[model samples]
Target: MDFFELVNRRESVRGYLDKPVEREKIEKIIEAGRVAPSACNAQPWKFVVVNDKAIVSQVARKLYDPLISGINKFALTSPVFIVVVAESRNLASKMGKLVKKKDYTNIDIGGACENICLAATELGLGTCIMGWFKEKGIKNILSIPSNKEVTLVISLGYYEDKEPRKKVRKDIKEIMSYNNY
Candidate 1:
């Protein structure tokens, strides 16, 4: 698909089919993320792709709240969970963050995550980048080091619903300016 069409097609898929995503497709999605540009080329990101049903269930447990109805319940049905981890920043990225007063790690990881989602969309798969999850639980389950942090969890699979949802967004005129805001 064209870039514009891919962008339009990409959405947060909450429901997924029972079928598992192919490993080859998953690897390509990860490759896309791996090549994503980072601040100062500081690719401080690690991805844990959980395909095992048992491990996926364990990861999904961190996203659910039995007491709260409809709280990330859709995650349970996803066939794969890609845990995005933010590793410790290198010296250059650290200095850049301090000088610019910006969280470069978060920004870099965001780009990588976007790449993962876009790649998945291109591969005829669906993805949902989830921020609402138990970070500590996930880190423990994945055996992530204490220094590195769990950035986000992307649920991946085939969309259960065939209908396409319309995209809602601000117009270019409203969101863009010629030279200045």
Candidate 2:
């Protein structure tokens, strides 16, 4: 499929099938993220892949919340997860962050994460980028460092629903301008 088609097809897959993603496909997805552009060449990110059934189940527990009526329950059906972690950035990126008063690390990480998702879609796999997971619980379960921060938990597998929902987006006129806003 073409890039536009792939992007259109890449939606947040909530319901996953009872199948596992291939190891090679997972590696390729990570490779796509690894090559993504970063601010001042500082990757400032690490992906902790949880593919082992037992470990994936443990991580899923942290995603479920009884407080929320219907939130993150689909994590239980996910066969894999790629936990995005924030790491130490380079000196130039740090300086830029201080000067610009904006955290470029997260922005760079978002690009990488998107690349991962696109790669997964190309591989005929499904992915959902989740930010509502329990960070501390995930950290403890994965033995992550005390200083490291978990940014996102992306669930991955074959989707139970094969169709991509129609995208609802702003019109071109509302979001675009000729030369000025």
Candidate 3:
């Protein structure tokens, strides 16, 4: 499918089948994430692919209520879980001067996560982005260093149920403005 079609078809899947995602497809998704643009080319991101059932369950246990209810459910069904982490860089401490003030790592990692989601949709797989877990618990379970922050957790597998209805959004004319607001 083309880009527009993929974008429209790509829904946040919350239910998944028992089938496992192939290693080749996972590699492609990771590759897509790696190629995403980053601020200043820092690319300060790491992706942890969790396929083991025990670890997946442990990570799922960290999820809280309401906000992550669907994700918590998806975690139990999807065969693969991908955790996106952003490494913190102390530019001032390293270079003796401050440079960019924004959290570039978070921005870069978010782009990478988007790439993976789009690629998964293109490859006919289902994915759900999750971010309502307890960070300390996830860090302990994954053995991630203190310097790295968990940005998102994605559940991946073949879809089992129909996609949810798309949430309504304002039209371009309604939201967009002319040269001046």
Candidate 4:
């Protein structure tokens, strides 16, 4: 698929088929994230792919909004999830962060997460990048170290609905300014 088309087609899929995602495709998705660039070559990201049915359920349990009911309930239909973990940046990146007064770790992780999603879209898998999950619950379920941050959880699988939903967005002219804000 064309890159533009792929980007447009990639949506936060809330529903997925019952079929399992292939392991090869999952690996390819992670490979895309692995090759993503980060500040000072920090590469501060780890992807925990959870394709096991039992674990997927456990993770799903943590996705709903406790303050409300039925929010993120669609996650129950997802067959797989790739948990994006934020790792420590390299010394150079850390110094840069200090000097620039900006933390690049989360920014770097965002790029990697996008890469993972785009790769999945290219390989005929649907994905939803979730930030509304319970981070502590995910850490415990995945055996992730307490120090590591669960930045995002991505639901992945074949879409139950193959049709692409039209994307709503701010107009280009409103969003872009070439030389001035």
Arranged by lDDT with the best first, the candidates are: 2, 1, 4, 3
Task: Write the residue-wise lDDT of candidate 1 on 1-181 in tens digits.
Answer: 9999898889999889999899999999999999999988999999999999999999999987676785889999999999999887888988988999997888899999999999999998999999889888998988898777898999999985565589788898999999898
Backbone clashes counted, model 3 = 0
List, residue by residue over 78-173, the lDDT tens digit for candidate 3. 778898887655544224225433556666778898899999998989898987778888999999987677889888888855554686778989
RMSD of 4: 1.2
lDDT of each: 0.91, 0.93, 0.80, 0.90
| Predicted structure 1: clash tally | 0
Clashes of 4: 0
Model 1 Cα RMSD, 1 decimal: 1.4
User: Once superposed on the true structure, which residue ranges of model 1 sit more than 4 Å away at CA?
Assistant: 161-163
Worst 10 residues of 1 by lDDT: 159-168
Ranking by TM-score: 2, 4, 1, 3
Best by lDDT: 2
lDDT of 2 at 128: 93
Q: Candidate 4: worst 10 consecutive residues by lDDT? A: 63-72
Superposition error at 63 for model 2 (Å): 0.9
Off by over 4 Å in 2: none
For candidate 3, the TM-score is 0.85
Candidate 4 or 2, higher lDDT: 2
lDDT score for residue 26 of model 1: 95
